[model samples]
Target: MKPVSTWAAMLSLSLAMAGCVTINIYFPAAAAEKAADRIIDEVWQLKPDAATKEGAPSR
Candidate 1:
């Protein structure tokens, strides 16, 4: 019974320590900015609806 309790305590302690790990991730700002600009340009290049061509008010 004592051995089981000791084992349980160690496992809980190990799990608690495991939860404290830190992960560092780095993002490349230049690459992200380039990708965002490309997406924005593609979106802006799309043609407007036909209603707008006739001078109708766009919703």
Candidate 2:
């Protein structure tokens, strides 16, 4: 009974510590979107077939 109670207490303490950590990350979503657009434009220029055609039959 003592071992089981001790194990339960230890488990509860570790679970409490899991939420105490801090993470900081910074990313420029606008800059990333601009870069992605440029890449897609370049790829589309290289392969015009990749562009979706207007008035095409929908799948």
Candidate 3:
């Protein structure tokens, strides 16, 4: 009974320590924002002012 309780305690302690680990992750916020902006621009098909282009063909 004592050995079983000790084993259980050790297992719980190991699991607790594993759960408390702090993992540091590096993220490039500026690059992510730029990429997101580019995707949004592509999705919206943003274009410059049509009137500004003197040579633009009109349909």
Candidate 4:
């Protein structure tokens, strides 16, 4: 029971430290294009109705 409490305390401290740091990574345009293609393919595969709705002109 004592070891469990100590481990939990240590985990909380580690998580607090992890929240202090930030990371920003910018991907290249080619990678973004590939990802967009994949997302579009999946969305169209799952939701053709949504595709038609998006294509329709708004009044």
Candidate 5:
């Protein structure tokens, strides 16, 4: 009886521990940096006269 209870406790503990695992995924730093730079450049490339030209009312 005691052995059975001990085995049950250990099995339950192992299962609980198994559910607590973590997996880490990594991104390549250089590629990520380059992508970020490209995005920043595109965001900053808006033409200064775009609003005036595009917002003018047409007859």
Candidate 6:
């Protein structure tokens, strides 16, 4: 009984420490493009929709 309770306490402490850990991640992004006049055609794997073509309004 003592060993089982001690093991549970240790496991809970380890889990609490892990949950308190902080991780930081950074991603590079384009803030501004040289051709600001041009419309954005794509982002990542996304492409422009036919209804959202440049110089035309969406239906």
**Model 1 regions lying over 4 Å from their true place:** 1-4, 50-59
Please tell me which predicted candidate would have the highest TM-score against the true structure.
1
User: Each model's TM-score?
Assistant: 0.59, 0.40, 0.58, 0.35, 0.51, 0.41
What candidate 3 gets wrong by more than 4 Å, as runs, is 1-4, 46-59
Of 1 and 3, the candidate ahead on TM-score is 1
* TM-score, ranked from best to worst: 1, 3, 5, 6, 2, 4
lDDT values for all models: 0.90, 0.78, 0.83, 0.84, 0.89, 0.65
Worst 10 residues of 2 by lDDT: 47-56
For candidate 5, the C-alpha RMSD (Å) to the true structure equals: 5.9
The TM-score of candidate 6 is 0.41
Candidate 5 residue lDDT tens string, 1-59: 34568888999999999999989999999999999999999989998777679986645
Give the residue spans of candidate 6 off by over 4 A. 1-4, 27-49, 52-59
Q: Measured by C-alpha RMSD in angstroms, how accurate is candidate 2? A: 5.5
Using lDDT as the measure, the top candidate is 1
The digit string of per-residue lDDT tens for model 4 on 1-59 reads: 44568888999999999999999898999999999999998877875466568786545
What lDDT tens digits, residue by residue, belong to model 6 across residues 1-59?
44568888999999999999999976444534534324454433365574376556865
Model 4 TM-score, all chains together? 0.35
| CA lDDT for candidate 6 | 0.65
Instruction: For each of the candidates, give the backbone clash count.
Output: 0, 0, 0, 0, 0, 0
Q: State the weakest 10-residue window (summed lDDT) of model 3.
A: 46-55
Superposition TM-score, candidate 1 onto the true structure:
0.59
* Model 2 segments more than 4 A misplaced: 1-4, 19-24, 49-59
